[model samples]
Target: MLDVLVVGGGYVGLSAAVAIMQAAPHLAIEVIEAAPEEAWKKDPRASAIIAAATKMLDVFGLWDRIEPDAQPITRMIVTDSKTSDPVRPVFLTFDGAVEDGRPFAHMIPNVSMVAALRDACAERGITIHHGLRATGFRDTGPSAELTLSDGRVMASRLVVACDGVRSKLRDLAGIKTVTWQYGQSGIVTTVEHERPHEGVAEEHFLPAGPFAILPLKGNRSSLVWTERTEDADRLVASDDLLFEAELERRFGHKLGTIRATPDRRAFPLGLTLARAFIAPRLALAGDAAHGIHPISGQGLNLGFKDVAALAETVVEADRLGLDIGSVNVLERYQIWRRFDTFRMGVTTDVLNRLFSNDVTPIRVLRDFGLGVVDRIPGLKNYFIREAAGSSGQNRPRLLGGQSI
Candidate 1:
């Protein structure tokens, strides 16, 4: 039996495998992905890698391969309404660096992130079964037996689920998740720009939702335009030129003319949180455990946190010759991560609700709160430090820039 069998080969799963292998190179590890080989080939969307998450990648030696292609965010500006709002002007502005003198976040293409993780796993001799799908599983004496879609059986001491929001493994394990669809959808696309973003990110809170312009490699920017579901469907179905026109209208001329990338897509928004993080010999991580609206851009960052905490807890337990899959060991991870996850989930949900409407009272109150936080240097610094990700337990060797 292998030491660990990881379900889902997304960012979180690979990160977990890397951590386990780094901690004990001889530990047998296998990752199963339902997609055919090269399933993530050329995924066009871009993702934000917060400083804390990048540091974890650095520990795993995966950041060096991805850093060259990443776009740093040197500053962030949040606006109450339009770019030219007259009252409650700039809701908030933050320098990109959180603490330890580093940029707060970096933006990289989804495919590039996947490529880096895949390369790292291959370099370490971690077997990734991409084409094989997980069908069912049963709990054996000291292991979990996983059945594949093609009639193959694999056994491991533990099964870690890092699948997406709709996790099949989580379902087979009977782990319930609370989920609700936001009446909104986010339209994401990249654009070539005339002026340099100067590593500055901007979020314009429109009545529909948040319109984020995140800096990207070279003179490009990634756009996350939120809208009501019905309106978003119509907008995405329109002709490219028509869509571009609407985009330009919402996205002001501060950056000169805007040109859309050839591809664009929209996804329905939602919030999902699992009822429990551990069950018997099973553990949950990444989107399987929690999913939140992207308005705050904290989705993947939270997943990285889960990877670090879970990996550290399991490694520590293994080092002590304890059962890594025991309820006690897994609950340690849950205890460390649940509060942080719940806080972020609540924050994003509240932000999404407060900003997705045109109510004058909320608009005024939120804008005022932003101003208050901005004016209080101590409070602002705390917020900034927290955003940079330095205040947490089970921090990995890489999170602090130490080699694992």
Candidate 2:
């Protein structure tokens, strides 16, 4: 029997496996991925990794490998306007530096981050089985048994599900969730610009939704353009010329001529929060636990936070000779993360509802709120630290750059 069995071999699952194995090598850990091998290479997405997550990666010895491909967000600008408006007046500006002159976040290609994580798993001798899915999950007091698509059953003292929001394992384990669709989809794509962005990230709140332009390496930027689901699909399926024209309407000429790459895709936005984070020998992580909007860019960071908290809980329990998967042991992780996850989910949902509209009174209220926050140095600093993931109390060891 393995010590830990991870379902869904994405970044979160792989990170969970690596975190535990590195701290407690005597424990056996393995990952099962539904996708075929090398499928992760085709992903054209990028994520904003906060400073705390980078510290955790640094502890894993993968940050040095990932940093070269990352573009630091030296500053962030927030604006509110309509798509037809010729100008978008900036409402809030944030200097990205947090503590010790470290930028609050960096825009990193998904490929680069996952590549380094996979390399770390290889060095740690962690076996990752691809092209396999978990069909069923059973907890038999002593261990959890997961049935794979090939009819093979694997038993482990603990089972961690890092599957996405629509996790089969979560259903099989009988975990319920609070979920609601926003009727919006985020259109993601990469764009090459004529002028440099100078490491500035911008979020423009238009009538449809918030459109973000995140700086990337060289003269490129990654865009997260949110719109109604139907409209997003139409835009994605539109011709290059038409799409670029529409993109330009929102993107403006700040970065000069912009050409979007062809690999654009749209993802439906929603909030999914598992009511329970653990059940017997099974624990949920990543999207299995919570999936929030991209308005704050904290989706992946929340998953990384889970990795850190879950790893510490399991490692410490093992060091004390306790059953790592017992409800008592896993409950620590739940207590540590559940409230924070709920708070963020509510925050994003409220923000999305508050800004994704054209109500004049509401717009005036929100913009005034933003302006107030911007003018207060102490409040702005507090928010920056919060976004950087370094302001919370009782943070996990890895997030603090310490070994478990």
Candidate 3:
């Protein structure tokens, strides 16, 4: 019997396994992934890893491998304007460190981050079964039995679901969710430019949604360009010339002849917050627990936070000779994360609704608010720290690079 069975071998699942192994290596850990072997190699998108998340990776011995491919966000500028505006004046600018001279976040290629985590898991002797889908699971008092799509059953003391926003395991566990779709979609793609970005990130709040230009390792930038769902579908399916023309309209000439990289994709935006983070001997992590808009680029960081908290909670429980999967034990992890997740979900929902529109009065108010925030250095620094994942009263052990 496996001590821990994690469904979904994405970054969050792998991180959860790694954290458990780091804290309690004696316990057996295995991850079941629905995708075929090496499928993660094809993810072309990049993610913003906040300072706290980076430290967690460092503790896991994966940051060194990831840092080489990461582009630090040394500065961030936020602007509000119409998509057709010829000029966009920056309303808020944050430039500096979160702590110890480290930038608040770093843009890391998804493939690089996954590869690092995979290598670390390999080093730790963690088993990952690819092409295995968790069809269902049930609590059997002391342990849970998981059913695979191939008619096989595996027993484990606990099951952690990181299967993503549409988690089948979560449904099988009978956990409910609060979900709503935004009428927008985020068009993600990489762009090669003649000019360097100088490690600066920009968020242009256009009428449709926020268009973010995040610096990459080279003379390139990753774009999280948002648009109405219908418009996004058309733009993504358009010819290269047409797409580039539309892209350049908002991208401007500042990047000096920008062209979209071949890796282009669009993801529908939505908010899906799990009503309960835990069920019996089961726990939820990553997208299985919550999904928020990309307006703040905190989706992955939120998952990392889950990884840290759940791992710490389990390890501490085990250290005290308690059943790691007991409702009482699992509730600790849920309590630590539920409110935080709810808070962020609401924050993103409100921000998306507030910014993804053309309401004149609301725009005026928001822009004025941004301007005021820009002038206040203390408040700006506070927000920077918050984005860095350093604002909470209690910092998790893994988040601070400390072992449980």
Candidate 4:
């Protein structure tokens, strides 16, 4: 029987496989993905991997492969209202860096990270089954039996679901989720500009929502512009003239002519936090466990955090000769991550509700709070570090530059 069977091949599932192998080299691991391998061929909407996450990836031996294509964020320009207001106002701006020159984060394309993960997992002899969607799952005392969409069965000591927000395995295992739609849709697209962004990531918080412009390599920037779902769909389907014109207004003239790249997409925003992270011999990681607004760009990192913690917990349990799939073992994983996940979830939720509005008195107070946080150097570093995944209980392998 296999030691662990991960039901998904996205960032979360692959990361878990890698981390487990590093944490306990003898543990047999496999990943089953529903979609065909690398079939989703498009420029990904991008994910902001914080410094600590980058460290974990470095441990997985992926940093070098992905570095050349990434853009380090050296500065963050956060404005309260308008992107076009030059001298009109400046609520708060964060010059990004750790210590002296170490970058706090890197803007990496989603597809590139997945490619790195897939290749690395393959190199480590992990069985990544693409085109095999999970239909359901059942815990058979000592092991879990996974049922795939194509009438196949895989029995393992532990079953992990990283199959996204609408996870079938999570549902099959009877795990409940607390979820709600944000009404706003994040319209993600890349843009090319005439001038270099100088590694500056800018976020302009409007009444509609935030228009975030994060720098990619060279003259490219990734946009996560929030709008109503209906509006976002129209924008996504609109002509170049209509889309670019609206983009220009919201994007402003900071980086010169901002032409949207061909890869245009929109996803409705929502918050999905699983009620119970584990059940019997089953565990949920990534979107299957919890999902939050992308305003903080913590979605991927949060999933990585779950992967790192759970892998370490399982490995330690194995060393103790305990059943890694036991409810007690899974509960330990839940305990370690629950608070951190809840804390970050609440922060993002409140921030989204606070900024995704135009309440006059509240806006002034929020802007004031922003400037206050920006001015305090020590506090700013703390918040920055927290956002970077350095604030929680991380694994030794993740921290000590070991492969995981």
Candidate 5:
């Protein structure tokens, strides 16, 4: 019998397994993933790894490997404008470092992160079964008996659902969620530019949604271009030249000549909040627990936070000879994470609704608010620290670069 079984071998699930083994090496762990091996490496997108998340990677002994490929965000600028505006004035500009030397965030390629996590998990002797899915799971008091799609069963003290926003395991566990679509889609792609970005990130809040330009390691940038669903589909379906033309109108000539790279993909935007973070003999992590708008760029970091909290909870419980999967034990993890998750979900929802529109008065109010925040150094620094994940209490040891 496995001590722990994690469904969905994405970064979150892989990290969860690694965290548990690192803290409690005697425990057996296995991750079941529906996708074949190496399929995740094809993801072309990049993610903004916040400072706290980097600390977790450092704890996992993967940061040293990831840092070389990570592009530190040294500065950030936010602007509000119409898609057709002749000029967009920056309403807020932020220094990307929370401290004197450390950057608040880094833009890391998805493939690099996934590879590092996978390698570390392999070194830790955690097993990952590829092209396998958890069809269902039943609590058997002492353990959860998980049914695979192939009809095989595995018993583990706990089962973690990291199967993403549409988690089938979460459904099978009968956990309900609060979800709604945003009517928008985020078009993710990379673009090569004539000039270097010098480690600056830019967010242009157009009428449709926020268009973000995140610096990459080289003279390239990753674009998270959001638009209304219908328009986003047409733009993505258009020819390369047409796409580049549309991209340039908003991208401007700031980075000199820019051309979009291949593998242009669009992901629909939405919010999904699991009503309960835990069930009997089961726990939820990553998108299985909550999914929020990308306006704050905190989706992946939120998952890392979950990995930290839940790993610590389970490890501590096991050390005390408590059943790690019992409702009593899982409640500690739930109480630690649920409020933070709810707060972030509401924050992103409000921000998206406020920014992704053309309401004149609201735009004026928000732009003014941005300007106020920009001028107040104390307030700006507070926000920078918040984004760095330094202000919260009871943060898991791993999140602060300490082992459990």
Candidate 6:
């Protein structure tokens, strides 16, 4: 029997397996992925990885491989305006560096991150099985048995589900979630601009939703443009000329003329919070545990936080000669992560509702609040540290760049 069996071999799953195996090499850990081996290479999405998550990657010895491809967010600016507005006045601005002089976050391509994690797993002798789907799950007293699409049953002392928001393993394990759609779909794409961004990230809160321009390496930027679901589909299917025209109307000429890459896609936005993070020998991490809006760009960071806490919990339990899969042992991880996850979920939900509209009174109130936060240096610094994931107390060892 394997000591740890992780489903969904994405960044989160691979990181979970690698973290445990690196700390407790005596334990057998493996990953099961539903996608083909090369499928991860085709993903064009990029995520904002906070400083705390970089610390974890540094602990895994993979930061050096990823940092070269990442673009640090040296500054962030927030604005509120209409889609037709000629000018977007900035309401809040945050300098990206924390007290230690490290930038709060970096925009990294998803493929780069997964490539580094997979390489780490390979070096650590962790096997990853691809092109297999998990069909069922059963938890006996001693171990959890996972049923695969290939008519195979694998038993492990513990099972970790790092699958996405729509996790099959989460359903098979009888876990329920609080889920709701925002009727919004975020259109994500890569655009090449005429001028350098200078590592500045901007979030323009329009009536439809927040339009974000996150800087990438070189003269490129990644855009997350949120619109109502129906309009989003229309915009994505429109001709390139019309699409570029509409994009320019909202994107402005600050970065000069922009041309989007052909690999653009739209993802529906929603909030999903698992009622429970653990059940018997199974623990859900990443999107399997919770999925939130991208307003704050902390979705993936939350998953990394889960990986840190879960890994530490299991490793320390094994060192103590305890059942690593026991509810008691897993409960510690749940307690450590549950409140934080729920709080973030609520915060994103509220922000999406509050800003994704054109109410007159609300516009005044929220913009005023943003101005207040911007003028107060102490408050702005506090928020920047919070976004960097460095302000919390009693964080996991890995997040602090320490070994378990």
Q: Report the Cα RMSD per candidate.
A: 1.7, 0.6, 0.8, 1.8, 0.9, 0.7
- Model 3 weakest lDDT span, ten residues long: 395-404
The residue-by-residue lDDT of candidate 3 on 229-254, one tens digit each, is 99999999999999999999888898
Residues 1-404 of candidate 6: C-alpha lDDT, one tens digit per residue: 99999998988999999899889999999999999999999999899999999999999999999999999999999999998888889999999898578899999999999999999999998999999988999999899999999999999999999989999999999999999999999999999999999999999999999999999999999999999999999999999998999999899999998999988888999999999999999999999999999999999999999999999999999999999999999999999999999999999999999999999999999999999999999999898988998988879999888999
Model 6 residue 254 distance off true place after TM-score fit, in angstroms = 0.6
TM-score for each of the candidates: 0.96, 0.99, 0.99, 0.96, 0.99, 0.99
Cα shift from native, residue 16, model 6 (Å):
0.6
Give the poorly placed runs of model 2, Cα more than 4 Å off: none
Residue-level lDDT for 314 in candidate 6: 99
Give the CA lDDT, 0 to 100, for residue 235 in model 6: 93
Clash statistics: count for each candidate: 0, 0, 0, 0, 0, 0
Candidate 3 lDDT score at position 59 = 91
lDDT of each: 0.86, 0.95, 0.93, 0.84, 0.93, 0.95
Name model 3 segments beyond 4 Å from true.
none
lDDT of 1: 0.86
Prediction 5 TM-score vs. true: 0.99
lDDT of 4 by residue, 299-342 (tens): 88888888877888898899999999999988989998888788
Q: Name every residue pair that clashes in candidate 4.
A: none
lDDT of 5 by residue, 18-85 (tens): 99999999999999999999799788888999998888888888999999999999999999999889
Report the Cα lDDT for residue 218, model 1.
Answer: 87
Score residue 193 of candidate 5 by CA lDDT. Answer: 99
